[model samples]
Target chain A: MFNWKLLKTIYLYDGTLNGLFTIAFDCYIFKSIPSNIIFEDNYISNFLDTAIYIKTDNEKSSRIWNGLYNNVSYDTLYNCYYAFLSCQKNKEINILKYILKAFIDGPKINTMLHIDYVLEVMKLRKNVLHESHRLKGLTRLSEINKNLFYASIHPDNNVIELLGHFFIKRFPLQNLILHDKNRNLLFLYNSQNPNNYEIISSPSNFNISNYSIEEIEFQNLWKTFFKNISIKERTNPRLQMQYMPKKYWQNLTELK
Target chain B: MDIQEKLEILSDAAKYDASCSSSGSNRKNSSNGIGNGDISGICHSWGADGRCISLLKILMTNCCMYDCKYCINRRTNAVPRATFTPREIADLTIGFYKRNYIEGLFLSSAVIKSADYTTELMIQAITILRNEYNFHGYIHAKTIPGSSQELIDQLGKLVDRMSVNIELPSNDSLKLLAPDKSKLDIVKPMSYISNKLENNQRLLSTFSKKRNFSLSPVTKYQKEKFVPAGQTTQMIIGATPETDLKIIKLSESLYNTMKLKRVYYSAYVSINKDSCLPTLDKPPLLRENRLYQADWLLRFYGFHADELLEEKHPNFNTFLDPKCDWALRNIDKFPVEINKASYSMLLRVPGIGVISAKRIITARRSFSLNFENLKKLGVVLKRARYFITCNGKYFDKISSFNPSFINENLLMLEKRSTPSKNNYSQLSLFENSLPTKGDVIKCLTGNF
Candidate 1:
């Protein structure tokens, strides 16, 4: 085993899966793990830190991807992918350590929750998937034109891609554009091509105005139903806040 | 009435039902369909009362033929009434479904003219949604207690789940409160649903085995299931004097015999002041909560009704949950070895739930866990610390295994944990006094 502590190398990448996997490929070739992995845009130089900017290569990334598929379990692979989607600090290194540990310990590494890095990786995955599931239920779509719908969300994690697959299946005949305002990413889907979706970057202030007249009417109807459905005798706002947090209330039509 | 006024009356009429679950169905969307069923139900929003808004819960109409005393829209009560045309119901379901405001529609109604008539109206609304709109989302419909078997069967084939509310616990209470409904009226639909679901299961297995059978029509309908998620029912609590033990036993029997998906206990909110009903300042919310806890024990925790409460102890202790109460009474099962205990044994501990028990089992396979690791595994160490042993070592905070002593400590823990003030109430303008020293001390100690 190479002594990673003596080298103290910090690898920088472009914050993409291919970029991170290429770094993983380089670590195996050099027989030494980097002391830390930092996204290139967020890197801060220091006198003691030796940062290496590894160029992302498709050949090298595919090699590591094939290695992981052949070695680790399917859950471990997906956990690595979802944990990478989380914007939590130091998640990249934890995911790397988890992947490397899975390679060494086989599929049983997921059960080893006692390990610190494995638990952190699992928690990151849980956090991202939880946000994705919440936004799937909470994302409100409004009709913009005749057959087109639009929804805007500000989720904590980059989960617009995940929600695109879900809404496409549920509304296969309707055109949809899901906006992630925080990440400035948009998921566009057309009813004609139900199988394909596009994630493109746009400005955060790109708001869709002129909602259909029926849209406002339905929003009022929903708010009225939301108000009347609750029993006044058993009003418990604390429990409601616990399930639907105040931070997510801005995107909800009824709460608004 | 206008549509908005009708929605106000109908939705207000339907709010008493506590069954809002959209789960247990796996219906997929056909091509060009507008919606699909999610096996794990999704809640788009929560109401102010903290219940999930998974389905558009509204009655087809608030006009009733019967005079149930606890009902808000009974025949004798002078309340505003409204009904929705089948087309309006279909349009509302599709509109709300498109906006992701609800998973699907939960259509219930008061008996307008006859049981068969109401059931036929409900079937008409769902038919428009299914055939005309091609909506495949979750639909839970209530079966009128005395509806014919043929009508119930047709309704079941269209909706995802069917329910018949056993509005009262006992036959005596049914007679006292609901004069028009009989015990036979409720049980007939329940048993019919139970037998039909069973027969569907049998047919499903046999038909799948013989794929080349000449029954082309049967093969065509193989995709559609008869009440695919099965049936659930609701019962009103605290309307009449029924012991907690009797309620639990009834729920247990319903699960075993009727094959129910769930049994919802609705706390009887006094809608109309009647001579037969008890006048309460608030609904029996705590008792209803305790019964739901006991119901969970019967369904998931491998617990029986007799194990939870005996004939002498007919009700639950208000301070402790049923699991903790059971654990304290069965104290011999204490200090279960965390490293070696079975999953079911781990679940019996006060603070360890199903998820934590599974976590402990999976985690212990790699390493022997200690107290610190138990907390990380999501065990409520405050409660489980009294009952569990980490590698043969008891939690150091407790000194005695005596049942009474542990019981007193657990009670104290419960008392300390419950909030002294209702935090979600409306702000009072008249009572604007500052807190005194005594009040501050009480607030700090959770004793008011």
Candidate 2:
């Protein structure tokens, strides 16, 4: 039998999802078959006799990404991207590599079964679905001074695209911002200001206390109304906890 | 009284009616009004108890001419009462709406002076909100039982929904408890509104036929336009000794015949010290919640009341929920093969809710699913473990398990702790029966 050490290869790149995806694309395009795979910063086995490190190339990565979009269906690319974002262990990368390898082999290979990869993709789909539902209930909008509506959210998944369907159709005229604090992602859709954003390490330190007195009064009235409407006879904390979990209570306006 | 004082008294009085949902209506803004009742609807805020507060749940007046023993605003109660003029209530609703404080108005009233008088006052408030203030937001008005048909017909056009409370399940209990209210009086107004809505739908359909291609303006305005959200009724549970079986049967008939959108079950809270009612220390909220779950099974899960509960077992088991209890009773239906079982069969398993059932169906369409796949789909196999099988093989703990033993074990696992507060404590009307400070903690967390 061939030596296992000669078959193994190790690749190092930026820890971000995009960077990892680029390496995966290069491995498929260049047909580099490795017995084992590990991330850049992770510890390696001392028993291995050989390990080849490949630096990620931006030009090759772009060409591969373009080929994925043009040659394969959009759904294929979406599934690959989602599987990458799931953040499963190193075994997941192997499964994803297998799926990409099958795709690159031929069109008939697309029908082949990769049970582990499909399950990983389903888990990622569930995360996206949950974040979308939570955003619908958790997004709290406040009127800013310039007649625009703004809201902030800290979600576990990158759900910026999911929130667009709800806010754009409902409030067509108003400008809005859906800030994901956990991921440091901002999705800004304003007719006056062209749609774009940059990742910030932390939310802006702009103080809301200095806003107009009218907004303050409105918040007070809403809190008072929320307090008065809850009937003591019908209090069910168990059910309440299920619908609005404690983890999200910190950001909800009505909860405070 | 000035508007503010009247608002305080009326709103405080109307706070107890728990039918504040403003969903399922699709009314839009018209040329004559300034507001629109949104289709997806609006949720103003959630209460401390976590119930959605969609409307300003309030009464026109707490002053009453009838003595309903279960009602806090009965005629003989020595509580301060106030009434809001149509203009005052309308202005308050507008002020609240403009400030994003409420979705709309949920206007109710105890019978003040007479049924006609109360109904007329409610009509005046809704009409002013529509014609004068140009407010087109949601309005859920309560139809007084003995009100005239003309008044009911008039109010139906201006509001989104109407409800006539069928407080007791049976006519005999209604006569004994609420002497002023009668079954005939309640059913009469409901029937009138039902006929009017049907006629409006027919008239609109016929007018559209005459117009050939486009919908006529009159047809568009009048087409099933009254109470487009339909109607709902509330029944007080545990007040008149009606069994869960009988209550559920009544709910099914109401849904089948009357076409009611919802039948709310309010657990009886002893708000009054009348000799005719029981003196329960706390409301049967858990029972009410169980009934709602059973109701969901009836409507969505394709179950009849008789199928779930029988005359011998009239009341639901307080320990286990209705679905779990049903599953235990029908143990032969267990060990459903995940890969081959249909959607309905999958739903019968304990811990498999509507969402999971649908997901299983969809996921299996692409490829055969096993136990591992079911777990990934979010099926709670902890409860469903004994019910489902994978590839014709039973899993651990489920294989060769006796049905009776499993049923007994489930019953024991579901038992709740008994309430520490004497459940038979005498109710005091003026003094707050609700616990205070440390006592409150015991009241909330103590076993019931």
All candidates: TM-score: 0.94, 0.73
C-alpha displacement of A104 in model 1, angstroms?
2.0
DockQ of 1: 0.81
DockQ of each: 0.81, 0.18
User: Candidate 2 — what's its lDDT?
Assistant: 0.71
- Best-performing candidate as measured by lDDT: 1
TM-score of 1: 0.94
Q: List the residue pairs that clash in candidate 1.
A: none
State which candidate has the highest TM-score.
Answer: 1
lDDT for B167 in candidate 1 is: 81
Q: Which ten residues in a row have the lowest lDDT in candidate 1 chain A?
A: A1-10
Model 1 ranges off by over 4 Å: A1-7, B207-222, B422-448
After the best TM-score superposition of candidate 2, give how far the Cα of residue A49 lies from its true spot, in angstroms. Answer: 17
